[model samples]
Every structure is written in structure tokens, then in C-alpha cells.
Target: MMQAVIDRIVEGKHAVVLIGEDEVEKIVPIELISDNVNEGDWIEIKIDNDGNIISIEQDTQSTKGTKQRVKNKMELLRKRSKRNK
Candidate 1:
């Protein structure tokens, strides 16, 4: 299993996924993933020896943590901008 985030859906057919700590982007056929998933949602994917995706599921806990981190960073940026202005 690998940790990934759904970055975006392209043309309604493929999903752009950012995988693991390195954030390597992989294009996935939308059908292989669960429908409840959306952009920025965290997911766990199971791949075979051939690098084929066999299973994927939404991971709520990771998503929440990631979102909180992003939100905090955005807030920090905003505060710095106010001081610079």
C-alpha cells in the first residue's frame, strides 16, 4: 500500500495523484478509484508487482492532518503579507 493524494481530475477520465513524501505524480484511470474521493483527498493504494493499481480507498485521518497543515501555512503567509504591506 502507498499513500497518495488526489491532486486533480483531468478531462473527467484520469486523476492526477501525488504519491508519498516525494509527491511523485501518477496519472490513474478514474474507474480504479472510489467515487467518494475528490481533489485533495488522501488515499491508500495497493499496487501489484507490475505496478498496477488493485485497490484504493479514501483515508480521512491523513486528509484532515494534511488540510490542517496547509491551512496553517496559508495563515502564516497571510500574516507575513500584512506585515510587509
Candidate 2:
């Protein structure tokens, strides 16, 4: 299984994903994806031995936690910037 973020979706065709820390881009067919997937959503993908997508699912819990952390950090930064100004 590999973890990735949905960078973008090419309508009914495919989805562009960003993988790993370096953010390697990969294009996967939309057919292999679970329903309601959207850009910036974190996902877990299973690839078969033949290099095909066996399964893909959104990591809702992880995504929520990460988003909350980012939001908190941004708020802190905003407050600090206001104090400095």
C-alpha cells in the first residue's frame, strides 16, 4: 500500500496524485478510485504485482488531523505576525 494526495482530477478520465515526501506525481485512472474523491484529499492505494491499482481509499482520519494541525499552525503564525507588526 502507498500513501498519496490527490493533486487533481482530470474529469472522468484520471486523477493526478502526489506521492511521498518529495511529492512525485502519478496519473491514475478515475475508474480505480473510490467515489467522491477530490483534490487535496489523502488516500491509501494498493497496487498489485502487475502494477495495477487494486484498491484506493480516502484516509479521512489522517487527513482531518493533518488539516487541523495545519490550521492551528497558521493561526499561531498569524497571531505572531500581528504582534510583530
Candidate 3:
């Protein structure tokens, strides 16, 4: 299983996926991604040694955690702004 994030969709045909801490990207056909997934979602991809995708699914926990982290960051930023004001 490979961990990746659905960075964005390209023209509704392919998805730009970011993998690992460095965010190395891979372009995958939209059909290969699970239907429930969307941009900014974390996903698990199973691929064979040949690099053919076997299956893909959304990583709900990772996605939720990421969203929460972003939300927290935004709240902190707003607090700092209010303090400055």
C-alpha cells in the first residue's frame, strides 16, 4: 500500500497525487481513484510491482486529521491577528 494525497484533478481525466513528506507527485487516471475521493483527501493505493494500480480508497482518518490541523492553524492565525490588532 502506498500513501498519497489527492492534490488536484486535471481536466477531470487525471489526478495529481502527492506522496510522502517531499510531496513527490504522480499523475494517475481518474478512473483508478476511488469515486468517493476528492482533492485534498488522503488515500491508500495498492499497486503491483509493475506499477499498475490494483485498488485505491480514501483514508478517512488521515483526511480528517489533516483537515483538523489546517483548521487549527487557521484559528491560531486568527488569534494572532486579533492580538496584533
TM-score for each predicted model, relative to the true structure? 0.82, 0.80, 0.89
Using lDDT, give the best candidate's number. Answer: 1
Model 2 lDDT, residue 41, Cα? 86
- The candidate, 1 or 3, that scores higher on TM-score is 3
User: Can you write out model 3's per-residue Cα lDDT over 1-85, one digit (the tens) per residue?
Assistant: 7788999999999999987678878899998887888999999887788867788888999999999999999999999999998
Q: Comparing 1 and 2 by lDDT, which wins? A: 1
Estimate the overall C-alpha local distance difference test score of candidate 3: 0.90
lDDT for each residue of candidate 2 in 16-64, tens digit (9 for 90 to 100): 9887788778899888777787778899977778766778888898788
lDDT of 1 by residue, 1-85 (tens): 8999999999889999998899988899999888888999999988788877888988999999989999999999999999999
Cα error, residue 58 of model 3, in Å, equals 0.9
**Candidate that would win on TM-score:** 3
Instruction: Judging by TM-score, tell me the better candidate of 1 and 2.
Output: 1
* C-alpha RMSD values across all candidates: 1.7, 1.9, 1.3
Minimal lDDT window, size 10, model 1: 45-54
Clashing residue pairs in candidate 1 are none
Q: Cα deviation in Å at residue 15, candidate 1?
A: 0.7
Span of 10 residues, lowest total lDDT, candidate 3 = 45-54
